[model samples]
Target: MCQKNCRGDCDCESQPMGGGQRGTKCDVRILLVGEPGVGKTSLILSLVGEEFPEDVPPRAEEITIPADVTPEKVPTHIVDFSNQEQSAEELSEEILKSNVICIVYSVVDDDTIDRITDYWLPLIRRVLGEEHSTPVVLVGNKVDLVEYSSLELILPIMNQNQEVETCVECSAKTLKNISELFYYAQKAVLHPTGPLYVPHERELTDKCKQALTRVFRICDFNNDGALNDFELDRFQQKCFNTPLEPQALQDLKALVSRQLPEGVREKEGDPKQGGLTLAGFLFLHKLFIQRGRHETTWTILRKFGYDDSLYLSREYLFPKIRVPAGTTTELTEKGHNFLKMLFEKHDLDKDEALCPNELEQLFSVCPVVPWGPELIYTVATNERRFLTKSGYLAMWTLTAALDVTKVMEYFAYLGFMSVTNAESQLDAVTVTRDKQLDLQLKQTMRNVFHCRIIGPQGAGKTSFLQGFLGRTAQETDEIPRAHLPRYTISSVPVYSQEKFLVLHEIDIFSMHDVLTPPELHCDVVCLLYDASNSKSFEYIARIYKKYFEKSRVPVLVVASKCDRSPVKQDYSVQPEEFCNLHKLPPPQMFTTTPATAGEPAKVSRDIYIRLATMAAYPNLKRLVHVLQSRPSWIGEYTNQMMELPPEVTAWMKVGLGAAAVTVMGLLLMRTLKNANTAN
Candidate 1:
């Protein structure tokens, strides 16, 4: 058979072709292209071979990769070219001749990254013919610059087209993702020998095959060529089919066995058993099978511990706080008990097993506010990559609330105490008993002004909280008889006290639901944005617009990720612009860098003092006026509510007495607490 020469510039003059390498058919060619400095040429050079160049030359070249399945050459051909000033018409002429094309951009360069589709694709389509399903790979180069990359855009754009074989981010300088690019591209272009591409995950593909292979080996016992009717029937009955449906099991076995590799007859000796051995079958399964959905199973394993074996025995299963590595994990006794309670309380249908969707619905009910996409995505993936530190802290707060007997009962006490408080006069913040916070700011956080911290993912919202607490604790170490507990929304203390409530990355929906009237409400809102990426700045709108009207309180705009650089909150816009843009007063900004080796860095006392000052502004006048009225005004409430019993009245008197003693201590009224109170 004769094949035409596709990329030929010359033709033979009526010459009869002889059987030789020169008369053979040409292989399909492909082109790789990108901006001038985007490593288009380097990728081809590495795949083929080239001599070392002392300095990079400003030129282009082409190389041929021969096809061979033998122990020698691999089948691949790549043409490397530059796209510095090429027009769409010229690039189209080049692309039409190639079977595949790759579009590359630096992931960190927002300008070039956006142009891949905006500038390149239309040109390619106009010149090369869109009717042809010519596979294209969107390559995001320089992924090592993760902090600088626009995740908001990258994730959405990559998700736009599922038909795209793979969206990859690689750093050419580090050679991080080069191999994966080649592997994925090769798989997308079909191979004549077999199916391609095995997923990197373990349980989804690898473990499933191991289980199947074990069953296959058992059916093929006695080193026979294949399983007979009795053996097949026994296997089906043992695995999934039941004994009551004997004929159905028998028929299903016959159907499955036929799909097995051919040439192996049901005899002791046969040539068809070449790849049918247990190990070979297992290998082939791993090499070819698609990974099944197993996020739920994996989540369970992660929460518990995977025991050494993927399969578990009933005995090794017990709840340990930490999951054991290298094993199929079993739920602990506590976990089992918790599951039983959950099923009994929530699942009215009473199905013995609950799937992932059901489990998510159950957890969602625990939140006072409805969960949003970000929180739902985190729950579904069962992996923590998408969750920020602040989000985790918010979850921790909720978990602590659940720790008490009832959720509403706990929040009622929390709600009541957060509303009222007395002022403290400590010059600085300090720590006592290693667990309590004893800063002057606690009085303001709980009693004076409402404060909230908000920010984008990884903008150091949690770290800022840690810094604030640590600094305040250090400042008031000299104060005797002072104890302030680190405050969380879930475990907020009752009684006439003040504390900073650190609510982390709150999902906007959840916050709104909780803050609705006739329920829990917040006094202030903090709007945080990331400094390194502009998209974080835009996200500030989504949070503020949702809750600003409901809050009717001051909103402080915090630009997080400030440690990447110094804080910059000064915008030229005036108050009208703020209203036009729906933004709060530009936040009082702060930046922080990591501590150096062997040096412990705490929050500066100056920042804490400033924060305390701002927080104390709202209630200082009211508190001072009430203090001026003194003993008469304070006792008015106690005297007016005459429905109280004598014992209850006595308890109230004791509480008032304690408050008076605390007030005297603050005012230096006496050297001690009456020296002998019982007397």
Candidate 2:
């Protein structure tokens, strides 16, 4: 594909295709269409020979211009159309395939020039459709035969048709404007004026404005609504591969200011806060198009990942990714770091959570905020129901695991690649190894774990899931619980790394209700019950005996609403005894009540961490069995040590430290008293 026949390496792997990383046209096809006797053949020959040809064929063989010879570093194909040799069907096929068509007419022949509008233009349109985007370049050949310029007659035709990009008058005999003619043809394909500008309006098109606006915001690193000298220089270097000199930068500022006074502003206290405002940025690009330099604007647009249609390319938003079954998607360390930076920067109130206003500001770069009101109840938030830092990361983590493609798209909309200087959002995401492989290795490196909470009615399961986000029962009750989300995800630190635990509240109306296989399929199971309800324990006890009798999936019995008075179960074996017999951990007590306002909530993380830890380490039951096989005294001591809640251990340390200090104080007092007696 890279030879004379090709004239280009468009099929090369490095070249970006449509909507890819660097948006660009790979090759240009220039097809010359005209009446039989126009100098269409002569123009092609003159461009190759640099001289008028004495003999012209009915049609010239198709020519391929090498990329090095073209002005735009793009290979070009030039084809000549003949009415005698090519049928109308063949001409239409060429019109469909060509990027730009050159309609050649004779400068001295009135009839031939008239046929341009009456015949060629309509012909091309009929083939490509009336609203086709393929550009048309009008060429007037045999200019030496006319003493006067023919542009006067061609001017009205151009004004009347939006498809005509430009008209060039040249003499194929004298080679006058011969090279200029084909250069315009190449320009028609490379940087057409229709999409970027409107000649009559003398302004950038609305679509062009939007694409540039996105580029400007991405370059505005400080979110100051302006591009300072540093940002401007970076933008220049990024798009053009060259930075501007100091004087050039000043000249640009002056140019925008001269055109529109408000285009550039001065911030009194902060010079960096003021540079090229959004208005100025738009004005500069508009000015470039007005001056016939739309290629410059197109360059900036493509560099920032906009295709010809002014939409982000697929390759830019959803880079190549594969997640095999039983595998999961997760954010990489860089992704986590970028999100942390965004949270810290946007938390203007510094309450460690984003209020609605702050959340809007953070997503201002995106076209629309992707997450909606349901996000409030799906993740952990502060007392005001605003998303907290952990909640923010948890939302992202949950998205990455569930719909990773959307994560990539939002990353693109959020300017992840631009801000991180990465090639793609792939650096921010990763596909974890399959769970089957993880099980074989007896260890998993996944940062997300799922726990399905199955409990009878009135077991406080709804409140339990909400508590994962630190929401109290009262807070949950503040609003109608009609469609309250059943899933609540929040970050739980397991030893060293932060892991996201997704609590799915499974509604079980009765103890004997059937549990489906998919319902039981999870990393861990939570048998939640109300500590105040005597019969709550029995519902889960029968559930455990029926469904998860000998399954490898770890199960934890959680006694929720522990803030209420304790009650005994009316089952064959009580909760603690049942756990011991099954080699499972003892029933854990949980409550979000104490977390309400002035109450201690140190133990709130205990149950969540245990659930997540069990999910992470599914072989914990085997470890318990090994411990039970050891000496009874050793087993008892190990169980006691492991079962102690972190809050209890902290209080034990505090009491012991206080006792030691009191003994030292007594010694100090005795020494003082003895010294005083001696005196």
- What TM-score fits each model? 0.27, 0.83
Error of 2 at 359 (Å): 2.4
Best by lDDT: 2
Shift of residue 494 alpha carbon in model 2, Å: 2.3
lDDT per residue (tens digit) for residues 1-679 in model 1:
2233345532332222211112112444556777667667666554443332334444346665555631112344566665554665667677877655677777766777667668666666666555444556667776766756555665555445322444667665567667666544543332211112223322224444443443453345333434555554454344333342556644433443455534224344732232244443343344343332132222222122122133321211211122122111122223223334444433434544334454443443222323344342221122222332333333323332222222222222111111111011010111121101212122322322224665555555544554453432233232232232222231122233332243334423332333333122333455666666645554555556565544434455555545566433334443225544643333445555456799764454333333333333322312322233346656686675466888888888888889888985664433122212311
Compare the candidates by TM-score and give the number of the best one.
2
Off by over 4 Å in 1: 1-28, 46-54, 69-74, 84-87, 144-155, 191-679
